[model samples]
Target: LSMPKGYAMLGRGILTIEGVLTFCSPQLNFVQMLEDHAFGAMIKDFDALKEFRQIGNRLLGALSKSMDIPSEIADVLKMTVRGQTKINLGITEAAEPLNAVNKMVDKLVIGIIDAALLISSSLICTTDMSPKIFEIPVLGMMGYFAALVVGIWLLNGIIRKK
Candidate 1:
C-alpha cells in the first residue's frame, strides 16, 4: 500500500516536531513553540478567527440572557468558581485554634526551660569560680542573660498573640 498520509501520519509528524522543539528548548513548552512558529504561520486569518470568536461569544451571551436559569443551576455555577475558597476558609478556621494552642504549649515549654536556666545560673553565681565578671561567674552571667532574652522573647510573642 502507498505511504499513509492520514491523521496517524500527521499526528506522528506533529509529535516528532514537538519533541525536537522540546529537546532544543527544555525550558519552553513544546505546544507553545508549535503554536508560535508552526501553527501560528499556518493561521492566515487570525483577525477573521478573532472576529468569529467575538461573534460566537456574543451569541452565547444573548442566548443565556434569553434563557431562564434556575436558582439551583446558578448556585451550582457559583459553587464551581468558589469551591476552593470555601475549602480554604474551612481549613484556616479549623487550624486557627490549633495554631494558638501550639504556640501556647511552646511558650509553656520555653518558660519551664527558662526557669530552670535562671535557677542553675543563680546557683553557679553563688560559687567562687574562676573567670569572674565583677566577682560573678562568667558562665553564670551568660546563662542568666540568655534566659532573660528568651523570657523577653516569649513575653513579646504572648503579648502579640493577645
Candidate 2:
C-alpha cells in the first residue's frame, strides 16, 4: 500500500509493530503526565494522613490522662491503643552545602544579568541609531560582547569550582 501523505514510510501500516508503536508513542507521554499528577495527589494525601495520625495520638493521650491513669502508664496505653507504631512525618532530603548554595545564587544572578544584556542588545540592534558596526549598532554590539564575556566568566567559574 502507498504511504499516506505526512506518514513516514516506516509508520504506514496498522498491522506492523513499528507502525503501532510509532502511532502510540504520543500516548505514552500522557502516562508520564498522569503519573506525575497522581504522585502529587498521593503526597498531599500522605501529608493529610500524617496530620490525622498526630491529632489522633494527641486526642487519645488526653483521654487516657483524664481517666486518672499514671502519666507513664497512660503513654504506654496510648501506644498500645494506637497499634504500637511510630508515624514518620515525611521524607527529608539533605540540603545543599553552603558553598553550593552560594555558588548557585551567584550563577543565578549572573545568568539573569547575561539574559538582560542579550535582550537589550537585540532591541538596540533593531533601532535606527547609527555609529554602526557592519550595519548593526555599535552599542548593541558592545552589549552582546559584554553578555558573551559574562557567559564565559560564568562557565569558567563553574568549571574551576568543579
Candidate 3:
C-alpha cells in the first residue's frame, strides 16, 4: 500500500523466514503523531511508564522459566540472547505471530494499539457509535472482552506445549 507522500507497505506474501519477524518497521510518523499531540503524548507517556515496569517483571519471569537461554546474561552477549526464547516460543504459538508478538516490546503497546485501532475503525464505520460504546459502558466492554479472549488464547497457546 502506497501512501500519499511516498511510503509503501513492506511486503505482501506470508513470510516463511523463521526467526525473522516480518512486521514492517513502524512508521516514524506514528511516533511523530504521538509527540505532536498533547493527549496522545500524555496517554502514551503515562501508559508506557506504567507498562515499562510491568515489562521488566514479565521479562524476568520469562528468563526464570527459560531452559535453553542463560538467565544470567553477560553484558556482551546480552543483545544477542535478548529475544532468542520469545521468538522461538512465540511464533510457534501466538496466533498473529510476527506482528502481534516480537515487534511489540510491551504487552500494553500491542494491547493499547489494538484497542485503539478497533475503536477508531468502529467509530469511523459507525459515526453514530457513542464514544461510551468504545469505552463499553452499555455493551459492557465487548472490545475488552474480545481482547481478553484473544489474549487468553495466545497465553494459553504459549504456556501449553503443543
lDDT values of the candidates? 0.84, 0.82, 0.55
- Model 2's C-alpha root-mean-square deviation from the true structure amounts to 20.9
Error of 2 at 52 (Å): 27
Candidate 2: residue pairs that collide: none
Clashes of 3: 0
Separately for all candidates shown, the number of backbone clashes (residues 3 or more apart, or on different chains) is 0, 0, 0
Models 1 onward score TM values of 0.41, 0.42, 0.20
| lDDT (10s digit) by residue, model 1, range 61-148 | 9888767567757877888887733433345466778988887888899999999999999999999987998999999999999999
Residues 45-149, candidate 2, lDDT per residue (tens digit)?
Answer: 787777999999999999988777677788888998989957778545635576678879989999999999999999999998899989999999999999999
TM-score winner, 1 or 2: 2
What is the lDDT, from 0 to 100, of the residue 62 in candidate 3? 88
Better of 1 and 3 by TM-score: 1
Which candidate achieves the best lDDT against the true structure?
1
- For model 3, residues 91-134, the per-residue Cα lDDT tens digits are 46566675666644555565676677557555554444455653
Clashing pairs in 1: none
Per TM-score, the best of the predicted structures is: 2
